[model samples]
Target: MRAVVVRSFGGPEAVEVVDAEVPEPAARQVRIRVAAAALNPVDAGVRAGVFGGAGKQIGLGWDVAGVVDATGVATAWSPGDEVVALDYGMVKPLGSHAEYVVVDADAVAKAPATADAVHAATLPLNALTAAQALDLLELAPGRSLLVTGAAGGVGGYAVQLAAHRGVEVTGLARQDDAELVRALGARHVTEAAPGSVDAVLDAAVLGEPALAWVRDGGTYVGVIPQAAPAPVRGIRTTAVEVSPDGARLAELAALADEGVLTLRVAETYALDDAAKAHARLAEGGVRGRLVLVP
Candidate 1:
């Protein structure tokens, strides 16, 4: 098997594709024959040693869409089951970026019936992060909510999901992204958020500034783990450390099939060109995910 990893993390140049032994599934786990994987910002973080796995080979990639090729005991999945999964780890010996990757069966969900592997690859991480962050917000229908970076991956999903739940979503994004944000179901779109929403989902990591947009006694949820701003004026503050829930992912996949969710692919790179993909991700302004096809 060939996998993407960083032996001595630094920059995109540090990302390397190397030969590796095929990993076997452990109990309650399944091995996926890699079809497609999405390269996320966290992969960049891993490449740059942001998570700090020094003097060791750290595998990259978190989102995977593929077929189950092997399964461990007590798992319902069978070989040839098409699925999507979140390989939830910052540093591991292998990841979904490889030709074959193993993940817990509990983290695997049926792939969206309406999407191909490339599009499905974009769902697990971003959508899960957005959905989980909204869970922390706990806003009811008709409540006002603001989503910063509403045009980005997680923010885009947050806007759509919140809107579907009947929340009045206002998207904060680049001026040029206003149209797209509105198309994603946001009731309003702006380059800046107007203060005093019932809650704010800070997908952009704006921290205190975004927190201020929430009204007193409201909620503020950040996407990054442990990076949320402190609560003030009786407001609640927390960050979502996204976890894999196959059941929840199944619902999201169904939403995509029903047209309540949209999947966007900014570009696709052959697995061998992963380094090039990282370089492109570093350039920024990518509207959707960059997928790697194996």
Candidate 2:
């Protein structure tokens, strides 16, 4: 199989496509014939040595949409099942930026029927991040929720999901993105600092600064691990690390199929052009995500 590997921890140039042994599923795992993989900022983080050891080389990807090709005996997935998954965690050796990848069956969900593989590949990691962040806040319907980086992948989904739960959403993004944010169900979209929101989902990883957006006893959820702001005035601060949950992914897919959620594909790159894709993402401000057709 062919996989995109980070040859060294430095820059996009460090990423290269190489021939590699096809991985087999372990217990409770299933092998997927990958159709597409989506790029996230975490990929650049991994390339820049945030998650790698000195001189370490590893496959790079998390979001994947593909079809099951095989399954381990303990797995419930069967061959030919179309799926999407968050295919990596803290200990990534191999990942989904490859021709084939193996994932725990419990972490794979049927891909949204309304989307093709490339579009479906954009959902898992981002949507899961949004879902997990919202879970940590435990907001009730009609409560005000503010999402930072609301035009980006995770924050975009946060807006939609929060709205679906009947929570009022105020999206913090550039003025240019107001229309798209509002289309995604944000009741308000602006660059102004939040005022007295019940909760703040800091998808932008703004750290302590975002805490000011939450009301005095409200909640602040951050994406950066251990970077939540200190609690003040009885306010709660939580940081979330997105984890794979097939059941949750299935529900998200259902929303996509029902037209309650929309998938956005900003650009597509061939597997060999992953370096260029990384460069594009690093440039920033691209709406939606970049997909790699493997």
Candidate 3:
């Protein structure tokens, strides 16, 4: 099996594709024949040693859409089951970027019926992060919510999901992205939040500035775990450490299939071009996820 990994930390140049032994699933795990995997910012963090696995080969990739080739005992999945999964970890020996990767069976969900592997590959991580962050905000219907970076992957999903729940979503993005943000169901789109909102989902990691957009006694949730701003004015503050929930992912996949959630692929790279994909991601201005097809 060939997998993307970083043996030493630096820049995109540190990303390497190396041949590795095919991993086998342990109890409650399933081995996926990698069809497609989405390259995420976290992969860049890993490559740059942001998570700190010094001198160790740290695998890349987190979102995978593929077929179940093998499963450990007591798992509900079967061989040949098409699925999507979040291979959750900052550092690992192998990841979903490989030709074959093993993940806990409980993290696997059926792929969206309406999307191909490339598009399905974009779903797990960003959508899960957005959905989980919304869950933390716990805003009721008709309440106002602001989604920073609303044109990006996670923020785009946050806009749609929050809007679908009847929350009045305000999308903060680049001026040129206003149309796209509005199309994603944001009640209002802006380069910045105009007034205080009921809550702010800081997908852009604006930190304190975004927190300031939240009204007193409201909520603020950030995607990065433990990176949330300190609470003030009786407002609740927290960060979502996204976890894999097969059941929750299943609902998200269904939402994608039903058109409640839109899946976007900024570009696709051959598995062997993993490094090139990382370089492109580093360039910024990517509207959707960069997918690696094996």
Model 1's lDDT to the true fold?
A: 0.92
Where in model 1 is the C-alpha error above 4 Å? Answer: 191-194
Kindly provide the TM-score of model 2 when superposed on the true structure, using C-alpha atoms. 0.97
Task: Indicate the residue-level lDDT of 224 in model 2.
Answer: 78
Candidate models: Cα lDDT each: 0.92, 0.89, 0.93
TM-score of each: 0.98, 0.97, 0.98
Candidates' RMSD to native:
1.0, 1.3, 1.0
- Which parts of model 3 have CA positions greater than 4 angstroms off? 191-195
- Cα displacement (Å) at residue 208, model 3: 0.5
lDDT score, candidate 3, position 194: 38
Query: Residue 221 in model 2: shift from native, Å?
Result: 0.1
Cα RMSD of predicted structure 2: 1.3
What range of 10 consecutive residues in model 3 has the weakest lDDT sum? 187-196
Local distance difference test, candidate 3 = 0.93
Stretches off by above 4 angstroms in model 2 are: 191-195
Question: Of the pair 1 and 2, which is ahead by lDDT?
Answer: 1
Candidate 2 per-residue lDDT, tens place, 1-294, comes to 889887677788888898988998888999999999999999888888886566556789999999999999888788999999989664366789899999999999999998999999999999999999999999999999989999999999999999999999999999899999999999988643544799899988887787777778888999877878888867899899888999999999999899887899999999989999999998999899999998
Q: For each predicted model, how many residue pairs clash, with residues at least 3 apart or on different chains?
A: 0, 0, 0
